[model samples]
Target: MHKLLPALLLAAAAALPVHAALPVADSQGEPLPTLAPMLEQTVPAVVNIFTRTRVPVQQNPLLADPFFRRFFDAPQQPRERIAQSLGSGVVMDAAKGYVVTNHHVINGADEISVHLADGRTLQAELVGSDPETDVAVVKVAAEKLSALQLADSDQLRVGDFVVAIGNPFGLGQTVTSGIVSAVGRSGLGIEGYEDFIQTDASINPGNSGGALVNLRGELVGINTAILSQSGGNVGIGFAIPINMAKEIMAQLVEHGEVRRGVLGAQAQDLTPELAQAFDLNAQRGAVVTQVTAGSPADKAGLKSGDIITHLNGRPVRDATDVRNVIGLLRIGQNVEMQVMRNGKPRTLNAMVEQPRATTVNGDKLHPRFAGAIIGDIVEGMPFYGKIEGVVVLEAEPGSPAWRSGLRKGDVIVQANRQDVADLASLRKVVRPNSPLLLNVQRREGALFILLQ
Candidate 1:
């Protein structure tokens, strides 16, 4: 009976048709498709950008000719110093000959050249660049060229597959595949308005301004930066989302500049300690550190220490999140903001205003206080101590503080025999004709002080 049962099972197995393993769909239940069609459609739009810049050479004082010293009093002679750099760009409009790239790629370049994938090389002229967003647009004199189509980057999600194409390390036309690591990542200090798409793609130096496309061959991001210690790809790469790039590109093409709305407020991230201290249920949102007087935020009744958690009903996870939303808004547009103050949440409407066009020349200014230069004692800073007094950042080289043996990072707790809590109090106590007596708190211990 057992032999008869085994024979029946074998006959049943033989009756079934032969089967082979087949590829299945992804987690979204979408079937996997060949990437060849996407790549074939997009690769032609990508171009390599080569730039040459001339910099002034600093001549050595020892190499100066004694005979020519009288005629040339200048310390250095101007010389043609050429610097070469490489990056990648994508053609946005073939008819208008417009190409988009990172501002850092072509900044200060005297000559720029674009190399197409089909062995065609063209000289490119810079139209405009916005260093705040790290975006730039260049123009070439060619029609009928391949151009790329932009996709809505706001629809992207984490774990979505993406492909990066660019010239990495001067190697032409390279491609790398990776998944979206994160979205709306900021505070990396990479750019002014950082709403970056974090990815694990192999992006290197020359890959900046290249294309980060989805499986549909649509441009979703522009490769901008990488977080690496060895100056090589370690999988942590960042890209400017296409939506932000498109907004800047349109402005650059039309007016040669980007105009961003500002609320005129200094913001800081809400730490877990601050969240607990303020009785916040969630450790999210940005806290207003300072509101500029007579600005949009001030006019809207936003004050310092107020925690902003939402804008237009959308969650503002941090200061960068608020900045990203405000920067994209147009001037005169009214936006709703939800703020938490004194353990209570409230909503306020604020009209966006134009940002100040002050040109910052990268100078570190020292605040003058009571005949001394002072700086704030920022929290969590690895400085001398945790006292609430202004530190002597600088001392006017040979001022009273310098002569009194007061050095930089010396925290001044008291001035004019009165307790000093901040720079404003220090300034008030240090009048021009008043006798200065400061009690300083050094790195070691507190010390009584007397300044002239």
Candidate 2:
């Protein structure tokens, strides 16, 4: 696409004004092809957003201890200050003044307001938001408003002409034009579920939650992030495809959160090295690294060493794609998957289920597991190779476990110098009135704690 795209873009740019009326002049008196007609329909739908948030400053952990805290006047709950941010939004429903933007734009906002193309500003009430997809919806009380048309993002193709409308660098409303550089771009670490529409459009810091539209003045994507080392646009920008945003918006609007199905499996990308080692013809697929026993995948006969090639007939590009497809599926829905086993493709069926929290009775493991649900890594709880230990599924705030310095994601590897490999062994070791010693490990690292 590298060489072919430039020629196509040049042809498209050359043909832009020949179909329409003659040239015109802008405020600077420079001869410019009239984009006013197109911008008129879309620019009004794009609104400026300002938000104010109050966040507490983090305090040192030592200051939280009773004895250490007594050394000083209990440090008043971390001081909070108002943080203000600005962005852009697209009005999707004119009658209701429903505006869609990135979740991060309105997250933790104490107050949100929308400034229209005219000299009017209205307070906006957050309707819903989904952090996983970084999409959000907010509504304003208004009667006569302009809304943009939403195009089927799935129909967008590479090199398609597109424009980004937003307040770049807080310079009011600005429009930049570029062609779609790529599609289905994933593994960018921008959001939990990423199926982005890549474009060369000039998106900047304040452009978050703005609109990315096509020639027909149809909303196709939401301007999100740009790949830049100097924090400036480098002709590489990303947008949340409107189709994915639409689906997430619907669930957020109705349920106030997104509910995704669990596959009970951990997978890795199908790299060229692994693909060759597995003797597969194509190098694009997700390889199962681990599958929990009796899980949805296991009940469907999936096992380690299976390469997932497709999900519900859609070709799986990598582990992220597999996750994207499954995470969007409704719970209890039957999922059809295609896998390559022994160099041959086979079909497997499974019912998408929500991962159940498996726990053991922690009454006896008081002060450590008391008021907490403890469990072994059995079904779909994230575990690395050869990691065997009891995990705390849930812990009450200020509970015995929390007081004893055990966190929710921490894995208890050793207790009282004894390796607590499983629940039975952990139960056998923890005793009452004994000085407790615990070795906990998280993604950050491991530490040893002594509890009296």
Candidate 3:
């Protein structure tokens, strides 16, 4: 019996350590780590943006009551309609009360209200907005406010942890955790210039202009758009990089608008067939299909059929790259471009110019034709799969061409029973007072035309 008791005592001692190794308990039976530090750092810098626009309210012509007429007749002024929109913004400068947000958030707004985390709502005025970059800066009358520190977005990589905070659906101050899905995303056609940071964060309708912060609670991006058919988050979202946003914000605050430099060259993506024809090693970079006469590229000796591989030492990944880099350049600044001519890389220097605000000419007809303009079909343009025709460059507003549903950019392959190659051929076929039969191709589909 004494031997058995000794063995039992040893067994009991062995089990004691296992019980002591159990995790310590809290009130919720979990580890206690405070989120106050992160909240304190980022919350104060985030602000709620509310915008109001006044639209003209049209009178209901069906209300024939004398009482209604008498009530609304005193004011001969246009009836005022109020539309309210809401989003989020980040306080960039505490001293100047400068805030950064998406341009669409405050576009055409008559009034703006900024709500701080401290339960203070103040009036905000638009400093400036750039539609191309989708960035805007606004100002409020406040001093010594908490402003967020910006992180270098260029340092971020895929799989890095990120946090997104905003007033989604007006549900005051929501935070979501995510990982960086991608970087340097462009050609989304969402905005003119896109270098978006792709993430899986829960960015919703009201999340636009919200801050996308890193684990250190530093702003890295501004939440902008999401790819979801239902308009809600579905594990795919995009944000404008903070670096681009910062640049636009600085320009907006100083110049009241962004001045983008232009190269004045028409570019197209190198298709696989074009790559084979040009004998390119890779189907990358933009192909200079045409250079506008007297433009910067033309003056710099850039010619058609040249492939632009680099701009100012940065790699031109695609057509978007050329646009984005050029767009950020200052007007009259000299920029260096690397082009591939005859399979040899050569450098050229060109002075950038301000982009003209001219409308795109889609009509491809001669001006002498009544309300018609002609354009030659440029090969290698992205026509929706397997369709080919000469594009329409212009159709005078309310002219015979306009009434016949002849839109700009429509491809006219056959006009007046003649295959149109260029403007001269089109003019030769269609005579004045002659009935014209045409066949047009559009992005959506094709159309048959008749003129009398």
Which candidate should be chosen as best, given TM-score against the real structure? 2
lDDT of 1 by residue, 25-101 (tens): 87898987777778999999999999999986767675466556667664545555899999999998999999999
lDDT of 3 at 237: 91
User: How do these models rank on lDDT, best leading?
Assistant: 2, 1, 3
TM value for model 3: 0.71
lDDT of 3 by residue, 53-97 (tens): 998776666444567667777434457779999999999999999
* Candidate No. with top lDDT: 2
Task: Give the winner by TM-score: 1 or 3.
Answer: 3
In candidate 1, which residue pairs clash?
none
lDDT of 2: 0.85
**What is candidate 2's lDDT per residue for 1-452, written digit by digit as tens?**
79999999999999887668644777899988656789988899999999999987776788767787778767655667789999999998889788999999999899999999886899999998987788999999997799989999989999999999998877899999999999999867677688999999899988999999999999999998899999999999999999888887777777777777787887889999999999988889999999988789999999899999999898898887877787777679888999999999899999989766557755566555677788875433335333778887777777776777777767888988899877888878887667778888865589986766
Task: Pick the winner on lDDT between candidates 2 and 3.
Answer: 2
Each model's lDDT comes to 0.82, 0.85, 0.81
Error of 3 at 141 (Å): 1.1
Q: 1 or 2, which is superior by TM-score? A: 2
Candidate 2 local Cα displacement, residue 209, angstroms: 0.7
